[model samples]
Each structure stands twice: as structure tokens, then as C-alpha cells.
Target chain A: MKTNGIELEKEILDQLPAIVLAVDKNFNTLYANNAALTFMGSTPENVIGKHCYNMVRNPQCKTPECCIAQAMADGKVHSIRSEADGGTGNRFLESTAVPLKDEKGEIVGGLEFVLDITQKVLDEKKLNEQGRTIRDMSTPTIKLWDGILVLPVVGVIDTNRAQHMMDSMLNKILSSNSRAIIMDIQGVAAVDTAVANHLIKITKATKLMGCECLISGISPGVAKTLTQLGINLGSIKTKATLSDALEEAFSMINLRVITTEAKQ
Target chain B: MEADSFRLLNGVKAMMDSGDEYSVSGSVTNRCYIACINGELSSAQMGQLYDEIVRMAEKRELRGVIMDLNGLAVLDSAAFCVLRKISGALALMGLKSAWMGIKPAIASSLVDFGADVDDLCICQNIEDGVRLMSFQK
Candidate 1:
């Protein structure tokens, strides 16, 4: 009956999702279950009798505020987020350290349970990027070309939107391999020194990547603001309207311009 | 330090001075460089901080500004909006703003909040923040 009970306990421990490790008060590894060995990227042979910090390569071991150490000292459970160098690579883990006690209620050692959470973190990051993309798309000033790329703007440019525009434009250009980019800013509210500089950077980057960037729909107010900012847009080709910009872009790429009358 | 100078609460030092509170010391300048965050910066505090930073940009010529949030637990929507506003405002002022000392939990929270942290200069520590800011200058 005792043998059966031990076997049942072992089976339950093996089925746990988290890696469980038992360490002595001195931080020496006493016993690690199969999950622990797998998570620590080591076999039981190499892990046992070794210092937990040495086996885990945790820098916190040298610190007085080490979670495991604090847990052992206070005889309480301590939760901490730590990074570990798994055999594959560095991995982020959420670790909970619990003090182990004997039948007399005296603290003997600590037990650590770690759960890998790298995937969840990456997913969150990706979702955030997606949200930004969606927000950028909702800007009425932005116009999507070929239903894949966007070019929208008019008036004074804010640095935040400019950065977002640059990133979105670059991603679109790279992904779609589009030949032309048309930025229409007919309703732009204002332009300042910083906005002009950001525009210049974006134009230069776009052109360097073998894509032709065309500016169109520049309002008179924006032109005056650009002049006041001492920004020289002479190097960049701009048109008074989006249609003209598109026509210029098509001509540069050696594509014959189709007239609206012809399409009708 | 006097008892009133520093209070250990919620595992953080809350230093209350004469209408000013220094949350954490980033580095030692002539005076101890500290991050002054208003009490439990809610959504309104985020917007207020962003506006204050923008006003500072208009008044002084800064090469770069550092948004040190070592004292913050969570930067919610309003806080995230403030960061965005600061980034935009800095560009208008011909300056840069680097976010420094972002804890992983806060970083993850920002991600969860769908904040755009990509364009801004982010550093893990105050030292790295200073280094990056100087490099930009």
C-alpha cells in the first residue's frame, strides 16, 4: 500500500506543468523532478548536489534580496520574475519560491516552481503592433493605394504620426514591393522645423530603398511654414495635387499614363 | 535622511518634500537627480505630465528628455497617450525623449495597452538612458 501511494505521488508530480525543484537552505540542489530537469536544460546527474544558482546561473544569488534566499530566511513563499539561460537560449520565466518545512514546522529548504512565459510575451508585443497599425489605418488623412499601401497627410505634421507613417510606409513598400509612394497633404494644418526634418528623413530613406517617394497636395500654408522653418524641399519632387504626383510617379517608372477619358 | 524625507511604502520610497516628491534617484548631479512623479499618477496625471514636458520643451532647449518611470507600476491608456504626446512634442521642439528604467512588468503592460513604444528610445536602466541620450546629442 505504501509503494502504491509513492507511485501515485510520483505520477502526479510528473504531470505538473511547472518545473519543480527542491533546494537546501544553502541553495544546493537537493532533488529536481523530470519537469525541472527539462526546464533547467540539464539532467538530474548534473543538477543534483550543485548550487541552485550555479546550475541556474542566476545573478540574484550574489544579492541579498535573492527570492529563494529570502523565502528560506523568512519561511514564506516568494514570487519573482527571472531570466534563465536555457540550453536553447535565454528564456523568461515566472518563478515562485516556497519554503519547505519538516513535520516539526521548522524550515529546511525551498522549493521553486518556474513556468516559461516567453511565448505569451511575444504574442502581446505582436498584438500591440497590430493595434498601432489599425490606428494608423483609421487616420482619415491616410489614403491606401492598391489597397495595400497608404499615403495621407496635409497641414502641419506631428512627429508621432510622422514616425508612424514612416514605419507603415516602409513596411508596405518592403512587403508589397510597390514602385511608387504618393503622400498627399492637401489639408495639412501646419509645419515646423521638427516636422520638416522628419519628412526629409522619411523621403531619403524611401528613395534609398529604390522606391520613388512623391509629395503631393501641399497647401499654401504648409509651403509658407516650410519656408519659415528654413526647410529646403527643392531636392524632393512635389506636385500641387495627388493626380499630378501619381502621373509623375508612373512616368518615372516608365509606365504609360492612362487618361481618365480612356478609362471611361 | 529625516523620517519625513523618505517613507517606505509599497516597497517603494515615497519622499515628500516641500510640495515636491522625489520618487527614485536616477543619478547624482550637483543635487541628487530624482524622478518627481505626482502621487499615483492616474490617467489625468499622465496627461498633465505630458503637457508639463511639452511646456518645458518650449521654455528650455533640451538635447533630449528622459521619461524615467522607475516609480510607476502601470502606465495605462492616459499614461501611454502622455508618452505619445511627449514624443510628438519633443520632435516639434527639435529635441528627443528617451524612456528609461522601464521594468519588464511595466514594459509588458505597455505592450498590453497597445502603446507604440517602437519609435521612442527605450533603455533598461538609468545609465543606459543617459548614454543613449548623450549619443543622440
Candidate 2:
């Protein structure tokens, strides 16, 4: 156990898993643990008494935005993310610098801790990219048959997301020049009156744009809510399932999905 | 004696007819507890709002409550359940409530979720909702 003072115990510093470097007020590396030597590929004799930038070789060092410089100025801990050259490849480091104070409660120097965070950073970036991909794939417009564009909504329909769906559906309808659009909500977990009303608005807007909008996938529970609320969605065409909606779409365009083979 | 009697406690009996259009944070006026939906209310947040409404109702001892959803932008199924519970609790207190200015989309969603909205009175706007409570009494 070491006393609470600016003087750091060499035993404690050497045992730590991360690279620990003690710096004087002049920003000189007063002491560097064994891990720091292995990390920088330098020995104690060559590393100590050297400027922090010289030993670490970081472009950001000694600058106003440097973590060590910030901690020294504010007398608090500051952290920065930087890349370091590893034996195999480039590694990410989370460097934290804290103010070191003497027993008299006077700021003496800075204590820095550098942790390897290469794997963590890579994992986070992958997760973010995957989330973006999922969002992009969530809204898919399918042309099941000619003149019919089906947009199957499978997630929560909030105002912003609903707006996104509207924009995409309109674009697909315009491009396909489809006379009808079928919105299937079979994958949606729940429907509130707000969502029902949102669907109606989209349908009305589609009609205004000279396209017929039909909603499908009304579960039994959803039907009960609509009837009890005394809300009449009769003006908007609806079907029990996507197949039924597709059949209706076919009728609107004067076509049908014929199952019979051509006779000789 | 009565909850609305607090207005008379201040010794001002001659009241002007502002037509029940003023807003009070958490109080009852003209036998109605009116609050505008101004915050983002998830199901959890609705519980906090519900507790406050119940407290105000018990204190003012009002007979009617009106929730104004004019500025509301976000809500979930939890909000409807909380409203249902609040309605049930208020019913036991011999007080009824109404929802005003509900966006058509939200109403459609509530209806789609199989919520028994017949128990709650609804109004197209705040002025119409305030008038509803007055007519009921």
C-alpha cells in the first residue's frame, strides 16, 4: 500500500497491465513502467528524462489539445484516442492523463495511462455499420405483379420512420408507374390508432397522386380496435392478407395471377 | 366542503366567465382537470404524469378531467394503458375525463391496438372539450 502523495510506487506501476508513464512539470518523462518500454520499443535509460512527444512519437503531443497538456492545465483527468504502431499492425490506444499532486495538495506533475483499445474500436465500428445496413434494408419495395408496388412495413412506425416510408413508397410508385400500391403490415408487432391514422393519411395522399393505396394484414385484434373506436376506414380499401391485396391490385389493373398452364 | 369551493376560499365570489379556457399546471377548474400534452410521453413517462394527475384530482377533488393532446408528437401503447388506468381510478372517485386534440394517426393506432376507447370521451379540439365538461355538469 502506497501513501497518497505525488510520489508513485515503482512496484505498483510495474505490476499494472497497461503502459504507465510519470511525467514532470516540464513535460519530461520522469519514469516509465516496464509495459511502456515494451510498447515504445525503448529501454528506461533511453526513454526517461526525454520529452513525452520524443518518446511516444505522437503528432498531437505538446499541442494545446493534448490529453497530458489538458490534464496539466485543468488539474484533472483527460483522455484521448490515438493509434500506435504495434509489432503486427496499427493498434488503437485510449490514453488518460491525470494530475499528480503532492501531500501539500500542490500540483507536481502528470500521470498517464495508455490502454490498448484496438479490438473494442473495431467492434464498435462494425456494429454501427451493421445498424445502418439493417435500416437501409428495412424498407423494401417489391413489384409483385405489373402495376402493383408492395411496401411491407415490419418495424415500429414512428412519425419520422413513417415519413421515410412515405418518401420511399412515392418514389417507387412514380418509377414503376404502378396504378396501385399495397401496404402490408403483417410483420408489425402492434398498431395504435395513431398508426392506423397514419396509414389512412398515406392512402389518401397516394389517391391524391392518382394512385390507389390499399392496406392489408389486419389481425383480429386490430379489427376489434378499429370497430370499437368508431373510426370508419371504409373509404380506404383494405384486405385481410397480402395475397388478397395483390388480387385486389390485379383487379384494379385488369390482370390476374393465372395458375393454369397454357393448353395445347 | 366541495373541491371547487377553494376558489371561494379566497373570498372572491363574483367570477368572470373566461369560458373555461385558461390553463393551470396541476389544478382543477370548473370541475375539470385539464393538462396539455407538452412532453415526450413513453409508457414509463406516462406513469409519472398519471400519478401527478391523480394527485391533483384528489386534492382539487374535481369531477372531470380533460387531457389536451394538441401539441403531442410521440406516444406509445403504454400511454394508452396509463390513460385507461387513470380513467378507471378516476371513475372510482366519481370523476370522468376526456381526451382532446388527439392526432388521427394516434387515434387510429389506439383503435388498432384493441383499446376499449368507448369508456373515454373524446373531443376534436380544446375549446370543444372544455365545453363538453361544462355541458356534462
Candidate 3:
């Protein structure tokens, strides 16, 4: 039973997620747990008896804005968000210093807890980039086709996305000197009134640029939405499927005969 | 000197002198002054300055903050973000904030980088900015 209790205590200490360090009032390192050693990239032998600031190479210790010094002076808990270079690169860490008290409630030392939040910060940045990429893809703009632009737009067009789509498409049409453009929306779920107006604007922009924009892959539901939106598609060239759009685009640029001959 | 106490000034104008990237002038309603930074504003310096500004705002209701960047050749994104946050915090304290003396090239670069300056009141010169904030009084 005694051995089991000791093993349980060891297990709990090892399983703790935070790096824990105990330091003297002067900020000298007294003890460090396994997690702390791992975090600092050092062993207990090298860190023991050294000033914590010296070990971490903290330049602010000599300055007036030292949080550790303030905590020691007031006997209060202090927390700071700081960056540490852990041999790999700079990493963000949340460090908390709590004053240690003895039986008589006298301040003896302090315990420092360090938590690495580098992964969390990186994840948030990546998520933001992904959101921007997705928004750029959904918007009807020619910017997506800078290097042979291809848009496989699937789903309904609302007022907001439609406006974005028009802007993107017009910008691309003016910038790129491509002979033909293809917009495939075979899986589109629906279209609204504002969406129809945006479509008209896109067609007008393409005509002004002297480049042909082909719409293809329309579903039955999309066709119904188009009618309800009161959009006149009489002047716009469209195809039943993406394959049809490609064929039409090639023909418009006088590349159909050459491509057919090559295939044959 | 008391660690937290600071003199208040109404306006601050800084210009670079003799290899120094920053200089300060005018009354500081807040403890801190507008340092017309010509070069880099390192993270450490920014953190220290921000801490001082926060303390000053808490002690005395800081009325205005203006950062004149007439001589600044480069303004990094980190510095821009810090300024944005500081401006937002000052606004909460009913203090007016403006960034003046920005060169046309730097302004264009900021826009190209997609830095949101829409919330910030910007001026081409310090005098114009002071005039804009005069209504705050």
C-alpha cells in the first residue's frame, strides 16, 4: 500500500502539463520539475543555484519594468506573456509567478509556471488564412484565374457573394489577356435577384474587355432560381456541362479544329 | 521619483536628430509623448512604452495621443498593430487618437499590406491632426 501511494504521487507529478520551477526570493533557481527542465532545454544540475533571469538571459531584470522584482517586493502574484527562444525559434509563453508561504504565512519563495502557447497561436493564424482563401474562391472575380483561372462554383448565389463574384470576375478579365474563360456551376443550389443583377454586370464587364466568358454546369434548381430572379440570360453564352463549356470556349477562340485534329 | 507618477502634456511632436530615430515635444496630457519614430520601434521598447501609457491613462484621464511619423522611412506591421491597440484603448478612456505626418509612400505601403487604418484618424501633417483633435476639448 505504501509503495502504491508513492508511485501514484510520482505519476501525478509527471503527468502535469505545466512546467513548474521553485525559486528563492532573489529569483535564484531552487528546484525544477521534469517538465521545467524539458522546457528550458537544460538539466537540474546546470540550472540549480543560478539566478533565473541570468539563466533565461532576461535583459529586463536590470530595468524598472521587471515583473519578477515587483512580485518579490509586494509578495503578490504576477503574470506576464513573454517570448522565449527554446533553441528551435522564438516561442510565446504565459509565465505566472506565485509567492510561496510557510506555516506562519511568511513569504518564503515563489513558484513559477510556464505554459507554451505557440501551437495555439500558429493554429489561429492558419485558420485565418484558410478563411481568406475560401472567401476568395467563392467570390465571383477574375483574380482567381491569374494563372489559367478555373472556377468550379457549386451552390446557390446570394447577394453578397454575387457582388464579390462580379468584382473578382471583372478584375480578372481586365488583367489577364486570356482568349477564353470558363465558369462551371453545375452543382449550384439556387440564385437570388441580386445574384442575377451581378451576373448581368459580369457579362457586361467581359464584353467590354473583349474576352468571352462561358457559363456551364447548370442544375435544374439553378435554372428555376434564375427565372425567379428575373435575370435575362438571352445574350449570355451558357452550356449544359463543363465539357460543353470547354468545347464552346475552344471554338470561340478558333482552337476546336486544331484540338480535334490532334485527338484524331 | 515615484515609479508610477508622470507629468501630463496636451500635445507631443517628435523629430529625428543625430542618428536618433525618435524625438518628442509639446505637452503630454498622458505620461507618454508621441515619439515621431523614424526607424524601427523594437518590441521591447513598444512593450515598455505601452505599459507606461496604460499606467498614465489609469492615473489621469489622458485626453489625446498623436504619433507624428513625418521622418519615418519604414513602419512595420508589428508597430502598426501596437499603435492600433493603443489607439483603441485610449478611445475607451474618452481620449482622442491620431497618427500624423505619414509620408505618401508609407501610407500606400500600409494599404497594400491590408493594414486596417479605417478606425484610426490619420493626418498628412501634425498641425492638421491637432486641429482635428481640438474639437475633443
* Candidate 1 segments exceeding 4 Å error: A1-3, A15-17, A39-46, A73-76, A83-90, A103-106, A135-264, B1-137
| TM-scores of chain A in all candidate models | 0.46, 0.69, 0.45
In model 3, the number of clashes is 14
Please write out the lDDT profile of model 2 over residues A1-264, one tens digit for every residue: 666654456767777889999898888998899899987889989988988788787878768878887888889999999987778798999999998899998888899999999999999999999976776688787887777899989978877667667667766765676679999888877777877777776775455333688999977877888888777898889899988998998888788777898889
Judged by DockQ cut-offs, is candidate 1 incorrect, acceptable, medium or high? incorrect
Deviation in Å, model 1, residue A207 alpha carbon: 32
Interface RMSDs of the predictions, in order, are 13.0, 11.1, 14.6
Candidate 3 lDDT by residue in tens digits, B42-97:
67666655665655666655556677666577778998888788788888877777
lDDT (Cα atoms) of all candidates against the true structure: 0.66, 0.75, 0.65
Which of 1 and 2 is the better model by TM-score? 2
Against the native complex, each candidate's DockQ, computed on alpha carbons, is 0.01, 0.01, 0.02
A60-160 in candidate 1: lDDT tens per residue? 76587677788989988898877777777877888888899999999999998888988877788899999788766644433344422337774446767
TM-score list, all predictions: 0.34, 0.50, 0.35
lDDT of 2 by residue, B1-137 (tens): 78568868544534432322233354456777787767566445576677778888888767678887756665567776777788788878777777765554554445445555544666544455566667755
- Give RMSD to native, each candidate: 18.9, 15.8, 19.1
Backbone clash tally (model 1): 9
